[model samples]
Each structure stands twice: as C-alpha cells, then as structure tokens.
Target: MSQTESTALADVSALRADLDLVDAEIRALVGRRRELSREIQRIRQASGGTRTDLTREMRVISPYTEAYGRQGTAIAMALLEICRGTGAPPR
Candidate 1:
C-alpha cells in the first residue's frame, strides 16, 4: 500500500475511536437524564400531578427543533418517551 493510503487508514481508525468516546459520553448523559426524569416523575406523582406535562414537553421540543429542525424534534420526543416511566400514554 502507498504511504498516503496507510496514513489515511490510520486517520480513519483514530477518528472512529474519537466517535466511540463521544458515543459513550452521550450514553452516560442520557442515563443521567433518565434518572433525573424518573425522580421528577416520582415527586410529581407524590404531589398529585401528572407524570408528563405537555406544555413543558413542548418547551423541550422547541429548542431541539430550533437547533436541528425536524430531526431534532424527533430526537427530543424519543428522549422524552425513554425518560418517562412506563405508564399510560400522555394525553
């Protein structure tokens, strides 16, 4: 193989390693968010409030939409669903 080809392959490998670290960090943050969300749900339920709040969800969705358009909205909604404890769907 040419020297240039070998260097490019090594670069690709390094870049993928970086991507792996980023993926790990993102997973950690998501897990933390889920923990926090569940705790909030518990407190809200204790206070006789619904687990999911549509108005607040919209607020969450808005920044995602502004940052990434349609795809961001989908990402935000998915996160919301994942964080919400198993129960009836929010109205």
Candidate 2:
C-alpha cells in the first residue's frame, strides 16, 4: 500500500480502538443502571408503589431529548428498556 493509504489505515485502527473503549464504558454504565433500577424496584414494591413511574421516566428522558433532539428520546427509551425491562405488566 502507498504511505498515505497505510497512514489512513492506522488512523482508522486507532479510532476503532477508541470506539472499543467507549463501548466498554457504556456497557459498565448500563450494568450499573440495571443494579440501581433493581434497587428502586425493590423499594417501590416494599412501599406498595407501582413499578412504572411515567413522571420519573419523563424526567430521565428530558435532558437527553433536549441535548440530542429526537434521537435522544430514542436512546433514552432504549436505555430505559435495558435497565427496566419491557413495559410488560407484572405477572
């Protein structure tokens, strides 16, 4: 390959490495969110509260919506699903 092509390939590899680090960070944060969500679910059940909190969810989604526009809402909703599970009614 030409020197220019080799240099471009190296840059792409470096960027991919950065993306891998970012992916790891995101996975760690998602696991932490899941743990926190489980704790909240436990407390809510103990206190006779419902599992779903629309108000709190909207609050959680608000900043993302503001920062990223429509895509932010989508990302927030996906994160919510990851942390809280689908909105399936309790058995």
Each prediction's TM-score versus the true structure? 0.91, 0.89
* Residue 27 C-alpha lDDT in model 2: 87
lDDT of 1 by residue, 7-56 (tens): 99999999999999999999889779989999999999999999988999
Candidate 2: list runs displaced more than 4 Å. Answer: 87-91
- Which candidate has the highest lDDT of all? 1
Candidate 2, which ten residues in sequence have the lowest lDDT sum?
A: 82-91
C-alpha lDDT of candidate 1 relative to the true structure: 0.90
| Regions of candidate 1 where Cα sits further than 4 Å from its true position | 87-91
For candidate 1, give the lDDT of residue 48.
Answer: 100
Give the distance in Å from residue 75's predicted Cα in candidate 2 to where it truly belongs: 0.5
